[model samples]
Target chain A: MTTIQLPPLPRVAPALTCDPAAISACGADLLAASAQVDDLGTFVAGRARVDDWTGEAATAYHQAIAPTGRRADAMSLALRGVAHRVEEHSAEMQRLLDRRTALEDRQQHLAQQVAHLRAEVATTTEEGAAELQADCDRVAGQVQAYETDLDTWVSDLATEESEMSQAFTRVLGADDVDRIYGGVADPADGPLRDKPGAGASPAEVHAWWAALTAAQRRAVIAAAPGAIGNLDGIPASARHAANTVALGRDLADYAHTEDAGVLTDDERTCYDNALAADEARREIEGRHDPVTGEPIVAQIYIYDPAAFDGDGAVAISAGDLDTADNVAVVVPGFGTDGESAPYQADRAATLYESTRVLDPSATNASLFWIGYDAPDNAPWDEGYDGAGVVTESMAAAGGERLADTIDGLRASREDDPAHLTAIGHSYGSTTTGHGAHDHGLGVDDVVFVGSPGVGGDTDHASDTGVDPDHVWAGSNSRDPIADLGNHGWVHGETVFGAGLGDDPAEDDFGAHRFQAESTTRGGAYSFGDHSKYFDHDTESLANISHIVNGDYDAVQEAEHLHDPFLGPVEDPEYDREPTSPTTSSLTP
Target chain B: MEVVPVSVGEASRAWDEQHLDLDAAATQIADADTSGFTTHVRGAATRFLAQWQRHAEGLGTVSEQRADGLRTTIADYVTSDEATRGDLVALLTYTQEVR
Candidate 1:
């Protein structure tokens, strides 16, 4: 909303020359020339007064000397000579005036030059400030990454220490004697012997199981019914004890007498079925190609129930399209797949829900929930670095897929223009940028949420290959992952402008279309981490809904910059929510 | 002039080595699909040969001597980062196709 106003130019010396130094020098010369003119004028005026008095005295003397013509001639000749002397002084004054005029002109030129230099210096200084700010932003992004890594490491270490402490406690408890102990008296036996005067009596236990060897463990587990089944509630330590006992019993029974033979029809059937099921599941999962083998997770979701109006039941394949009134393709970031927990699904589902919430009357809308080729972890996936490289490639592929989908959709609905919006999160934002670059993925609006950085400059239209008029962004303060991504991960030198100017945390998302705050810090319904950008009812999701529904006024009214790097500030009403969120039926 | 023998991977390493002529070497190797040379690739040819050899062995094509021949020729002339060995395979395919 801020406008810049340039200062007015000041006139000093002559304006002929553009040099500031020359103008300054001209001004100085003019000042001295003017002073000389003033002094000379005063001197000439004084001399004129004295000459008038002398003439009067001479005329009086001639009249008193002789009434004859001889005295008159002498007086007239002397007066003529004085008149000539006055003429000479007049010529000298004219010459001074000419010199002063030339000096004034030079001074004006010098003045103009000085003004120009001042403006240039100011502009250079402003440019330098911008560069410094960019450097600061880059460093901040690095710091954010470092901080996240440190946090993860510390958390890991803490978990390990806690587990170890629990193990030590169990050992100590075993020596109390009140707790049952067997099997070579356990490792703590020696310590117990040193302090035997203390605890309660050991609980009675069958000696046969405690003496089981390591080989017995596997045999016992294999023979046991449902040994690994439905043991979710059993603590790991308890499970280990039960397994150990089972193994010991099995080994003694097998070694002592296995003469009965291996005839159990039910066991064979069960084993075969289990193996077949495992193989089937593996086939369904689809292994990666060995040559270009990279870990990736893929999924497909169908939204439409049936072929309405005799339209094809099949959705268009990649780079093909069937027309629809509204189509949205949501690209998720790293660590996302079909097996993702309810929390992740909820985040992804929010996009569809938010879109519907924005436009209740959009009945023909279809949303493609894409999780194709998403990695299990980041920076480990081959060809994926940041928004600039792998994400960009993903976007390129995704965009092609989207284009195909749109074309197929268009084929079904002849009247629809096939409006598409790409809503990407974190690394997905980079993919969105690459999609824009490919020019095949026609998008009306591009929104990035909880993004570290997109692989393009914030000048989205020109620099990022998207229409600068249709970019949106958001970030949250308590979401440390988003903050880290925004600060340290240079997605593509993207600048955003959605943060609160007062809070340093807000600036991390960069200057962009929109950055919304979570309802609470680290809220489950808000962007919680690197992956959950579209939590249920957060401001970030609201902004995305508004933009996708063609409610630019609503977004602008909210003071979110669509293209922060553009000219002119226009105000329009952007309702906090979409047009009519409840009209569409999403119950199925 | 004959182009220097350097893959992009090698050029990258050479740059790290602080070699003064690395830039020139990079230029030379950038488009060197010249006669009699193994196809210019982005990564090391030697690694590609090893990976393929392992694959071949697993597939029961036990011509160990032929594999060894390919590997030696590669190790002698190719110097590059092992991480991007696939690039070498791609180049070799191009080389065979041209031949």
Candidate 2:
């Protein structure tokens, strides 16, 4: 009369009541409302000082409407906060609901198995009953495990709901709104009281930033956006937010001052820089992600409009820097500044697209880092002064900054490092060389394109703090600037050259030189060819893309340049012939 | 005292336009749907929307009031100018008769 005990099957109901689409729609509406309110505030502020409406009444009107504008800003910020939370919650709810559905289906299957075993056990003979009992025990154990999993899932759902409520409470609190978005602190005092200084290491900065409360971070961004926007080790998304706020505020302030005809000379330069940055951001933002079909995310990694004495340092990324499998920093050469951001961003976008085309599954990000004060004039310019281009001072300084930036990237993503590469063009290659040689640029690969020289003292590719095999160079046959580097002469006579450094494309430079012939024009030498390395459908761009995608075997190699007694020689195996003019002194 | 009627009228019209924009923004925020959210989130969203609506409406009310104030001020200024002109004309007429 001994009974075979079985575990009871539990109920398998999953309540998934949230509609993701509706929640997303609500978030969109909230964002629209926020924008509208912002526009209203801007209108009120602009209209406060009407033409020919001066004197006591105008002053009173300005004073009276100022508070309304402040209120509008606060309200808009509050709406944005709630919208962000709601949107995030919607995504989380969808994931949880999916998991719950899977669990419920498993529960149903297990319940059916239990019912079948119970029915068999009731009709089986003694010998058959033992086998049926074994089946029952296995089914009961599975049911018990599923019940445990179900309990854990239920607990997780409850925890998520509770966290969501807390988040909403924090977002909707009135004090938080006024304190965070009210712009209560002075800009000169910096954003947060305890924020790391410029001299702090990236790791220190990252730690300091991670320790702040969410509200505190928002307050800091609102109070001193320029400071936070350019700080290294801050997450790209946060930097983007801070930089965007800074850009808008600066533009508005500059526009107001310009309208009043009181803009200073320095302010005018910064204004142009701001406009350029905005144009660059707009260009990237207008592009659609190939995979997601959504507007591409552009991060303003660096936004210092007044840096480099108004040459203006700026870096804009074509993808998410925080979470990408591969990352490349494209450093432009001479004549680059904030004004060059649009073109640089285009180049970065092209490189990004090329990487995506090469490998569709892998995530990639490309940054147009015009972080240094590049020489305003090229060495090949008609009346080129030897002040900036002929010397390696600018490159060395820029290299230091580049090293810091790369190090910051490493520190920020220490948990999951990316396949980082530095692609330098023209004098940027020199800067990159200096960075790797002098400062140990912590990148997996170094690519020098149309390089005049890597650095003044870097004679070998191995001197660039990377394996000589990993160092790559691409010099268009007709690129005059690429020929500015010194090549070893024949007859056992070492030539003391006046170029920036040893030519990376030379056979003795110990760097892999790739085919970079400019097919756009058939000239013996064209300055335009130097700029064509990054052009689409070009062998040079393809090779660079292969290197960026970490597919080194796919790269097409080219013959290296060698200096002979008669003239500069090239291997006949390569189809393109060297077209650079022969010169005794390679200054340019 | 030296207000230009054209400028005052333009300012008043601008305020009127802004008032409409603010009102529309307030309505948009207040009418945002929270029906798809779970009970706890929906409740929070409703409260937040209601509070933000008040703020927006408050700004809208200020805009409307400013527009009204500007309109009244311009009208009063024009009326005062007209009265002053009439007094000057009457004075000139009375002086001419005396002469």
Candidate 3:
């Protein structure tokens, strides 16, 4: 087995300030200084202007001199007000620096501890190796624990800064603070903030949003875009509008920051994702309809950077989810990101197109969910991540994310409920399977293609939460990567590193198999790759589109494999024959 | 003010990553060839691999019930990408028609 090289974990954020006195003093000083300035900066100007003049000539001189002096005085006051703000910002920066120093000191202490432990281990006898290993593991876990805590501290600091900006805005215009929060009456202690739309139930969210005035709604969209951008139970149009503004503004900011080389690694990733969001936007802008190459209206439901380790979470809909009768969520497999978003978008577009073809009046939207870390990433390998496609840990985690995403989608729907079908391809199938198996994934139907496994102990389609008949599986006969999941064949009882779950196509998995043309090299057991499941002139894509649109009858059944003993089996599709395969590409 | 479970899901991932993180850092324990520190680790891994192998064999019932399904799956395996075959060597040995 080959070993992978890994970099040591490094701390990413400064420690939180424990000096409440200093922080409180800074806040008090900023508030007092800001209050010291009159709202219009007119006091100095009034004091500087002359009251009267004696002669006509003197009057003209006084008139011009008085206005000029008044203007200059106002300008001076404004400059001073700005200078006071600068002072407060500078003070905040110093506090941050102080916190950083503390964090660095702590880190130094840990580093010394690690070095000491290493020295002790170096002289240990063979009998103590196990003890040393345990010690090292404990120390490393501690280091990781520190990094995690630091991230939380960083998150808190960011929140503090946002609140501070709100506070600053209040000082600028207390009367207009309502507008600044996008109609949130009082951002910190207001109806919207008291019960944020994020985690509220659908009815509650809708009710809260409905109670707001139109101007208030617009204000919320402006000031707290993320609040409405990702909140459940909001209209898709509203979310799209909010996200569009946010995307454009953030991308512009990121572009400048990235070009200046001032972005951290996570910030750089966010920058790339912003670009990807723009690319998908362009795709929607370019398309006229789901199938036709023309312009169409759409929504960018969510674009979050704070969560999921900056891999970020995004959902793009080609049609309005609230108005549509059908919604298809396409969960992609390994190596999915903004760079590959356009391709996934294209696939989504095609699914939308297929749904249209299947039914003349079927209103549909297709969404691409690349929200989770799919697997150990590589370029779009025919098999997932090339030689690194050895672990299902990522898929397992992605399953939970997928489950939550589906729940969010359901909660976000407006008007009448839409029939939602989740579709997954390759390792994505495994991710979805686990979602269904573990997370009570709420969906109407599920379809799988080029799946490995979902997770352990999921023996039937019903076990995945969806009805057995509603669970669909499609795999190309010549495809070689499908079996790596080890779902199709027998295995030793003690097999470790199993796929996410049982194969949905397996007879006992109780999934409906649909026909798909082989997208592999013409071979019995040789060199076919994954990724061709969506190729045109194939039955798989046709079946997947049909499933999404609820055109179940239109989905073609797989070819009879002619089981020599059992005649022919139906439901999940299967390959025609087996031949010897070379173990060339799948070594550690 | 509120501390939700941020580490709830991440804790497991961190443990899983130790193979790369801790193993690489403590090459003294991971690289068994010249390192006494790795002896315990190598033995533990072997035990795990062997134990899971037994768990994998419980599929004897599945193989019989879905022989034809397994046949087509095996066919796909033969024709599919060769990159993942070695990973399934144990299954292949267990499921081949002769066996």
TM-score of chain A of 2: 0.68
Report the Cα lDDT for residue A188, model 2: 23
lDDT of 1 by residue, A1-588 (tens): 222232223223222212222222222221222122122222222321222222333344224222212221222122122222222323433333354455455445444644544454455555465554454454445444444544544454344334423322332221221232222222222322332122211111112223444334322222221232112222222233333222222222222222224314433333332232223223322433222232111122221111111110111111112333455566665554333323333343344455555665652232434424444344545334232233344445554544444333333333445566777676566556555555444567777665544543332334445565676666554444444332323333333432211111222322345546543444332445444346545566666666767766766323432223354322121223322222122333
Clashing pairs in 2: none
Give the range where candidate 3 chain A is weakest over 10 consecutive residues by summed lDDT.
A578-587
Best by lDDT, which number?
A: 2
TM-score of 2: 0.61
Model 3 residue A442 CA deviation in Å: 2.3
lDDT string for model 2 (A1-588, tens) is 346665577668567688876786676556555655665655766765565667787778778878777776676666666666666777878888888888988888988887877787677777676677788788888888888888888887787778766765664655677777785332223336677766999888888878777767764564456666777788877787778766755665566456546567998999999999989988888876655666667899999899988889899998889998999999999778788889998888777777766666788899999999787665566234235776778888999999999998888888889999999999899889999999999999999998888886788899998999999999887788987877774211134433567778988899999877755744566788889877766778778878888999988888888877576656432465433211111123
lDDT by residue (tens digit), candidate 3, A1-588: 222222244564543433433333332222222122211122223432223323443344335434332332232232223323433444654556566676677677677767767676657777766677776677777778777766765765675455434433332332232233222222212544655534556557766776777656654554445567777667777787667656744654455445545556777878777777778766865665634444555578777754455656677877777778898888888666555667777677666666665664778888887777755355464345433344566767778878866766776664467899988887788778878888877788999887766566566788888888899987665555555444444431126654456656666567887776554446543334467566544567667877888888877766422223344333234434322221111113
Off by over 4 Å in 1: A1-324, A341-348, A364-366, A378-414, A456-459, A484-512, A522-532, A556-588, B1-99
Give the candidate number with the greatest DockQ.
2
Which segments of candidate 2 are over 4 A away from where they belong? A1-191, A378-386, A489-498, A569-574, A577-588, B1-99
Candidate 3: C-alpha lDDT: 0.55
